[model samples]
Structures are given as structure tokens and as C-alpha cells.
Target: MAKSFTKMLRAPDSPVKLSKIPSDAHPGVDSKADALRKLPKFAGRLADLQERLFAQAHGGTKPARQNLLLVLQGMDTSGKGGTVKHVAGVMDPGGLRINSFKAPTKEELAHDFLWRIRKALPAPGMVGVFDRSHYEDVLIVRVRDLVPRDRWELRYGLINEFEQELADQGTTVVKCFLHISRDTQKKRLLARLDDPTKLWKYNTNDVAERKLWPAYQEAYESVLNLTSTETAPWYVIPADRKWYRNYAITRLLVETLERIDPQWPPADYDIETEKKRVLAS
Candidate 1:
């Protein structure tokens, strides 16, 4: 079921576009260990691409702008943080703004879900990450019935429209769902229990939430059905196989950034004159 949902999300529209294997298709992948091997290479490539993006921004001076936003969603224990750490660690921090989304604070809940998200949008020549995002309104809020069915149902159009606006404005947005099996989550949860220092990360609330796995699955299906768009689609990362998941997501990011073909801004004709003028000082 997760496999089907993930496939629907990542399938390319044209044969010419680079293709990537959805992680959910792989039942086993040790993403952490594999990430150690692939991170240097992929991270290096991302850094190189980011340098071009940075040049684009700096060259703009007082002119154009561009940026990207990556939203990651997953069940508890999914490797969202790990993937972000390894996959995006190479990018320039000068323009990067990674926002880790969690349960809304009282002040945040007073407004719409997207209100908080809007505050974190990436500036030109940077990337932003939503650890968990507005999608939670469609997933958790629906699974837990925190809101009426109609209220949550309306969010699909809202999300689609929101993403459309971002895309129209030149923000390359990608949404990834880290797919983990119930058994895998159980194992990780147990390991979290036995480990001493990791104890602080354990939460009975997360365990209690595990009981509603089936509900979350259904909520995800609905969320995908409504929100998957050409501009911003959800890519499923297989969480069971950590290596494969890391590789798949890293590749997907590279593939997407490559699509943008972020180019360095052309050198202006006034550079010589500007340099001489500055040199006089």
C-alpha cells in the first residue's frame, strides 16, 4: 500500500527527465550506513551546485532571486533528520534556512497551519526544510480527528493552491514521505528504550501514536490523493532500508536541483569600471 502511494508521487512526466527509484519499493535499505559511503560524493555534488546557486544570488546584486523548499513528512522514527543531515549537510549555510517543524505552539495554533510555514520560506539562493510540515494538518489532524472531516478535506485544495503559488514564484519545492514498516518502527522504538543516552528522545506519546498506524496510512493516502501536484509532489523514502533510502533521497534531490539548472549570473559589463572605481579607494 505504501509502495503504491510512493510510486504515484515520484513518477516522472517525461522519459527525458532523470528517473529515481522510490525508496518504498525497496523493503530493505540501511540508509545510515549507506549514507556514510555516499554522503561525501553526493554532498560534494550538491555543494558544487549550491555554489552556482550562490553565485546566481550574489550576481543578482539588486536584481533577480530564486530559492528552494523541501518538505519532509514521516511517521515517528522515520529518518527525516538523518536524511537532511547527510543529504543537505554539504550546502552553503550562508543562504540556508532549515526550519524544523513540530507540534504547533499556542501562538502558532491561533492562526492557520501555513501561517507558520510561510514565515520559514527560503530566501533566494538557499534551501529550507520542514521537518514535519503543514501536511500534518491533513495527516495527524485527520487521523486523530482533531478537526472535522470537511475541514481537513478542504486542506487539499488549500495546499495545492499554496504550492502552486510557490512554484509560480520560482521556488523549487519537493515533498518526501519517509516510509517505514510497523515492525521496523517497533525495533527502533525498542532500541531507543534500551539505549541510555537516547532515552531523552523516547516518548510514550510516540509509542501511543504507533497504535494508530493504520489510521495514519489512510490519512496519508488521502493527503497524497489531494495534494500531489506537478509542481510539488511527495516522494516516498523507504525507511526500512536506511542505505537505499538515503541514496534514493540524495539522488532525488540532485535530480531535482539539476532540473533547475541553477546557473551563475552573467558577469555585467560594468565590472571593469566598478573595479577601477573601488580600487581608487
Candidate 2:
């Protein structure tokens, strides 16, 4: 089932038009209620797999330790934060590291773009979540013309190489673009403005950014085309319906972890001896 969705949602090598994809489509999910009901089971499996991965990294004899990094990229109000809150929230916080990347600091700009990203990577046996990532160097920089075209254009290969290195080092990279339609984004933004509690989330800059929607979409299309490699492919998740978004992401995670298939390390000490020692004590 996961394989089917992976095939359906993965970006192909050809050019893509974000408008062509339906943001509200729920493949294989019958209804919102059904999605909600299945979420807990996927969540539980994710927790268990994460625990096993953590244990294996700590105790397994393998030379390269294993970890998972989930990279989320999306437009404003496209559900990146919500995905982290709902899907990743189910995992044990002790084993998870959620990093939200904003505009680079003066110090960060001093070094290469990936320097900060390297610092935020998950350690062996941990699951790391990046709310926005290195792709920003291409997306926002290109859209806002923060950097010259020549500079930002060079980053596609660099980003691909960086992810390839991570894969070589035993990190499973799962990238998701929370694909939302223009109308859906506007509706969500309006909702945030109308609700007092969500007013804080409504940023004036978001409105400014929306004015460049076409440019951002083109930038993202480039991102998906150039960087969706076999080692770390990108999944374009439908984000119009919050419930379905959560379900799809949770399922993707579970599937990725299952593929990694970490196991409980064998006991280093004799189990009988430990049991007897504890009982005697």
C-alpha cells in the first residue's frame, strides 16, 4: 500500500505543474474518519520501530549506525508544522530531534549553507525532523532573489551530494513537500486571521510571500526535479485536508522505518547470570 502511494506521489524527472496535482486527494483512504482511525496504529508502529532503531545504534555491532531524517518542505500554511505536531508527535520525544530552520544568521551565512544543516542532523539511533531545510537556499533565495541566479543554481548538485553522503553513512532520508493549492493556502491564512488563538501564526510576511506564489512554485518544481534521487526521494503529499496529511506522512514514516528494519541487539551478558544476580540482590 505504501509502495503504491510512493509511486503515485513521487515527482518524476519531467517538469511538474503543482496546480495539476489535487491537494485534497486521499489515495486509498476512504474518508476522513477512516484516516483518523488508522493513524493510531501507524503511530504505534512508528514508535516501536524507532525504539528498535535506537537500540540497534547503541548496541549493534555494525560499523555504520542507522538513523532516519525526515525533511519537510512546503509553502506557508501548507501543514509542515502540523505534520510535525501530529505525525512526529506520536514518537518518543527522547529519540526525536525536531529542528526548524529559519533565515540564516550572520554567523551561519559565514559558512556554507549546509554547515548548520550538518549540525542539526540526527545522531545514530535517533529520528530527526527538519521543518524547512537546505532546499531554502534554492527556494526562498531564488524566489526573493536573495542571491544571484548563478549562486543559487549551483546548490542543486551540492544538495544532492550532501544527501548522498548521508545515505552512505546509514541515514535514511525521507523528504516530503506538503503540496497545498493556492486557494487552500488562502483559506488557511484567513482562518488563522479570523481566530484569535491562531492570530499569532498569521504573519504579514506570509502575505508578502504569497504575492510571489508563481515564482516559489517554479523554484519548488526545480527542487523536486533536480534532487529527487534514488537514495533520498521526495514525496509530494496532499496537504489540503489536515487529517489526510497526517495519515499520509505517518504512513510514509512507518514504511521507511520498516524498510530499515532495525532489530533488538543480542544480550552482551548472559541473561541467566543477570537474572540470578538481580534475584540474589
Q: Judging by lDDT against the true structure, name the best candidate.
A: 2
Candidate 1 Cα misplacement greater than 4 A, ranges: 1-39, 274-281
Count backbone clashes in candidate 2.
Answer: 0
Model 1, 125-162: lDDT tens per residue? 78788788899998888888888988988889999999
Clashing residue pairs in candidate 1 are 29-241, 29-242, 29-243, 30-242, 30-243, 31-242, 31-243
Count of clashes, each model: 7, 0
lDDT of 2 at 131: 96
Q: What would the per-residue lDDT of candidate 2 be over residues 148-192, giving only the tens digit for each residue? A: 998998999999999999999999999999999999999999999
Clashes of 1: 7
* RMSD after CA superposition, every candidate: 5.5, 1.4
TM-score per candidate, chains pooled = 0.85, 0.96
